[model samples]
Target chain A: MTARPKLVLENVSMTFQSDGKPFTALAPVDLEIPAGKFISLIGPSGCGKSTIFNIVAGLQPPSTGRVLIDGEDATGLIGRVGYMLQKDLLLPWRNVLDNVALGMEIRGVSMKEARARAMPLLERYGLGGFEYRYPGSLSGGMRQRAALLRTLLVDQDVVLLDEPFGALDAQTKSRMQEWLLQLFNDFGRTVVFVTHDVEEAVFLSDEIYVMASRPGRVIEKLPVDLPRPRDRAIVSTPRFVAMKKYCLDLLHMAEPADDLAA
Target chain B: MATKTTSLPPTRSLFTVLSLFGASDDKGRPIRKLPVRTLWSNWIIALVQLSILVTIVAGWELGATFGLIDKFFWSQPSAIFKTGVIFFTEGDAFTDIAFTFRSTLFGFFLGTTSGALLGMSFWWSRNYARIVQPYVICLESMPKLALAPLIIMVFGMGLASKVAIATALTLVVSTLTAWSGVQAVDRDQEKLFYSLGASRFQVFSKLIIPACIPWIISILRVNIGLALTGAIVGEFVSSQHGLGRTIIYAGQTYEIALVWVAVFVLSALSMVMYAAVAWLETVLRKGINQ
Candidate 1:
């Protein structure tokens, strides 16, 4: 537990100006993600879960405070983290192979080399025959898989996944969760995931950060004691069930306070 | 509209022929054999289209023969066809067509390329776009053909002036359309680019330009017609060559059949250009879009 944190959000906060008035979207907060941990941030809509992701991705800088990566102050700086959003956001025009090659190509790798590098990942994942298919023709689950593979190929140590499978159906979502667990381990990358489903958070995360809205802030941080290299079957375990129950209880408790003054 | 006028009656004749052969249609639910019906009717529709042309030409020919209409004014359809054949075979009609074609194509290429380039550059600076947008609207709202006299005066009533007029008509529309495409770009994709450490130039070249292709392709289709109109109008105003000038010459001499010949040639030229644009759109959009 004494391993130096991979990422730290020191007193991070956000306030937006709306209609000539001040609106605090996120209250001051400090969070540390230990190296190589699967962390989840679960909160209701507008709880600044996405705000934190935007700040961490450097798409938006926090109004105050800073972010640190490898103990280096990396506040308001982009390209340090691999970020995947809710929508797959695949270019409708590009086929799966080219889409997967985008991140490397942007970083000055020759397209031929980048494409050669991406080929094996496509084969290993479920997209073997779909390398030449356009995004519009792909099934939703397959598109998300392509998108996730694209992010993974970016090869950043820390990855931010915001509701990556939030749009999947129950059966597909379950299947994706199992697949993602495999990926998380095989890739050995630190991930900060944002999701609303408590069971999903409990299933995948090493630590879960529960957030409260109305001047959004972190309310609870629970460490999962479940053994490593988990599978979907573990969700039925009493320990997993209890952990999920505790997180759900925290979220519901935070909900009724939504009417409180900001 | 052609189908509505005379195409439907042929279906009755086909039904009569089929019924005579004991071939009955389900006409009951119309759910089955639906695609078969479309496939069957398409051929009939094509034949009917040919019949419609025959009917119009026969009517015009008969009218000219019997004096229901004046051959001097309407000109016999066969005479017009003969005149067209003669012009193409023995006269300089092909030269005229080539002149109009060159001016239209040149104007289209120059206007769309320059206009779309300027329009897309607006994405580089929000302040620049805000300042320039109103002027674009003003230019768009004003009738551009009115500038023909000035353009002709500047370029001198030659191929250059015709190209200038065509360019003037197409430029503003392409500017507005390309600018709108830039504005409507998906913010999520833009953010994704930024997240990938793409520089502003990379975002512009790789993302913005490719994403706006459909819009630009649409502009291509529209601008081709406008360019033709500009070139013809420029010729009408003043020109030594082109199909438009030939039409003016034929009209002044009251050579009605030659006027009809030039008009038909212009129509054929417009169709060829339109077909070309449609093909280009398909080819360009195939890679970037579904």
Candidate 2:
């Protein structure tokens, strides 16, 4: 039998109470992320993609529905899955090494052991000589890598990335995407990524979910047939272009008239 | 054109002076040459400061010599300096200094620790914080000096009274600022820790406390002055020996020079205390960040 999906969401929805009004941020939605697969949720602004992430991360409980990890109910339980946001969120008061080891430290690993474990990862990730440098002294790309290291150090199998590289410049972003892909390949972990960039989604995902806003729901689940160990050259391929175009069309149709006008 | 020509000579002289102070680039262009202003070296700044101080002292001495001002009331700088020397060399100034320093140190430590702890506790409990908010505001607004007699009455006329007043003065503001600091911790960071399965206490000790440290250090800097003021005020109300008591006794006997000497010593003491707090901030920050 096919391995039970690493993470499953059943009819999960979020309703935020704003100014005494019940506002539906996300409608009932179902998602299944298979083990050792990379899935991307691509949509326009206000698509409640981040809302879904917040739910899965257990930062907030879903107004309705359930979350399951390896078929076990984990509704509203925090610290069960790794979550990285758009911002690096590295503590400014911490150096690169300490920042990377923070999650493990919080998980009760002693500081000395955490640092020792982090050293090899730092060197492998090209952050070795700068391990003791403060986050402020690092470049944006380096900070994000450090943040990813922090997320990974805790040893969560399913990692949720919410536009983690959205703030990066184009060149740096491309390089980081390749680095992340290699890391993901090596780790063999389940990744659920959220991004508005179609090309990014097409480049990294094994499967892509096109979401619609205004009571957000997944409108389409498109399988990316791109080959393994994909790189920048893949973006130039006709199939890649077709996939990107397909996602763009769905996103365009998903946007509200007001958003189009602006 | 006429104004530019007239300004040229002075501007050139200023540049030359700045160049003399090593403000020139490799190619000999004056670095950041402001037309009318000359960059002063640390030595020059020190010299200018010393000159101003000397001028003030000379003016006071000359005024006293010429009878332009009443030396009995104002006390000439020379006589004040002589009294300060005597206090250091021949009098009980050392004992007074030691007593006041000890009281200030104790008060500073007690006030800082209590303020920081109370602030963190408030951060941990919203209900308790809300209940205590109004009372804290009221106490903070009430001039701490007004409670000096009561503090002295309760704690007695010794070092304990001085420390009590100092802690009282510092506690409110330090608690308020530190509480605000904890409140102002980045929402993302807090969420990050929570997502990592950090318990509420873990979130507090790992994230909230470390995040609020800069604020705590800043409050400590402010508390140093407040603590000193509290200690002196306590001594002023009732004390056997302290700089405050010395000043009071000198003033009562119209020993104006001795009073000036005490004032000088107090200012010096304040500077030393402020420097110590600043050094602590640097060391703590380095340790935490590293």
Candidate 3:
């Protein structure tokens, strides 16, 4: 028998009330993510990409449908999935170590135990000496790393990353992407990444779901056949370029369809 | 072939000479130097401030000695200082100081604790907040000192009355300020905590309370002055001991020097209270960061 998917969304949809009028943000959609797979949702602005992350993170209940974790119905359940938004969202008052330990503490871990668990990760994540420093004092890259560490320390099986590297400079973004790949591989957790960058979608995803706005819906599923242990050089390869071009074309097609819907 | 013409030295303007006293830059513009980092060390700035105070006191003494001002109406600085020495050494000044300090402390603690708790409760319950907001605004606008007689009648002419008045003066402002702070907590941070499976109480303790600390400290600073004002006002209405009562008695008996001494003591008390709050803020912030 085939193993059950790690996460499943059965006919999830969202509609918001805008100025007393019904505004559909997302059409009913279904998604299945296998255990330990890296999936990405690529779309334009207003495509409800973030809405999906919010739903998965259980920040908002979907207007329709159910969420399942390991085939167990878990709709509207929060704190079961780790989510890292585009902004680091680090608590300014907390030092780097304390911030990283926050999730564990919330999960009923003692402060001493949480700190002990967080201690090794700080050095591993290259935040060792700066652990005692406030978020305000850290650089953009360091702050994002600390945020990612916070998300990871939560010990969730499914991690939802909403354009996690979107705000970084090109060099930092590329570096973080590689670091995330290794981290995910080591952790073996299923990840659902959302991004507007087609190249980023192609580079990081095992499968990319192309979405269109104006009542957001998945239009295509493009699987990346790139070899394992992909590097920066893979991005310039012919196969990688071809896949990127195909996604760009799909996105361009999605725009006209969005306009028609508008 | 260049002509060997000699250039004359530039004439120094009057303003240029004045700038040597750290009033302006080399440009000779009429600049107002604040006694900050530009021209002096911090200690030097403090010394300059001290010099200004000494000058004022010297002027007052000279004016009284030369009969430019009546020593009877406007007391001499030296006489006031002598009166201050006597008040501390021989008079019941220590008892009055202790009484006023105790009243202010009691009011400050009661007002701040109740205000913070009420503010957090209001934040927790929007319906209650909506119902009470108008009343809070109205009470805040009312001059608390006007209720001195009522407070005295209720609590009696003792420490309780002074504390009650101080609490009245402090409560409304602290409540409103703290409520605004709670409201101003970053929405994203709240969502983060919620998404982490934090209960309402956990969110409050971990996020809201820590987030509202700076505002609470600011309110504490403000409440200190207000509490003192309440205590002094309560004493003025009816009290056997306190700097306020002493001032009133001195004024009635035409003891201008004694009045000046009491006023100086009150000023010192305010400064010490303010410094204590500032120290508390530093300690609290350090704890948060750690």
lDDT by residue for model 2 (B250-287), tens? 99999999999999999999999999989998998777
Residues A138-183, model 3: lDDT tens digits = 9888898999889999999999898888889988888888988888
Cα lDDT of candidate 1 equals: 0.91
Q: So what's the TM-score on candidate 2?
A: 0.90
Say what the interface RMSD of candidate 3 is. 1.6
What C-alpha lDDT, on a 0 to 100 scale, does residue A13 get in candidate 3? Answer: 96
Model 1 clash pairs are A93-B288
Error of 3 at B111 (Å): 1.7
* TM-score for chain B considered on its own, for each of the candidates: 0.84, 0.84, 0.82
Which candidate gets the maximum DockQ versus the true structure? 2
The local distance difference test score of each candidate is 0.91, 0.90, 0.89
Q: Order candidates by lDDT, high to low.
A: 1, 2, 3
Q: Residue-wise lDDT of candidate 2 within A1-262, one digit each (tens)?
A: 7888999999999998899998889999999999999999988878899999999998889999999999999998998999998889999888899899989998999999999999999999879798989988889999999999899888999999999999999999999999999899989989999987889999999999999999888999999998998878999989999998988988889888898788
Better of 2 and 3 by TM-score: 2
Error in Å for residue A123 of model 2: 1.7
Clashes of 2: 0
Task: Return the TM-scores of chain A for each candidate in numbered order.
Answer: 0.96, 0.98, 0.95
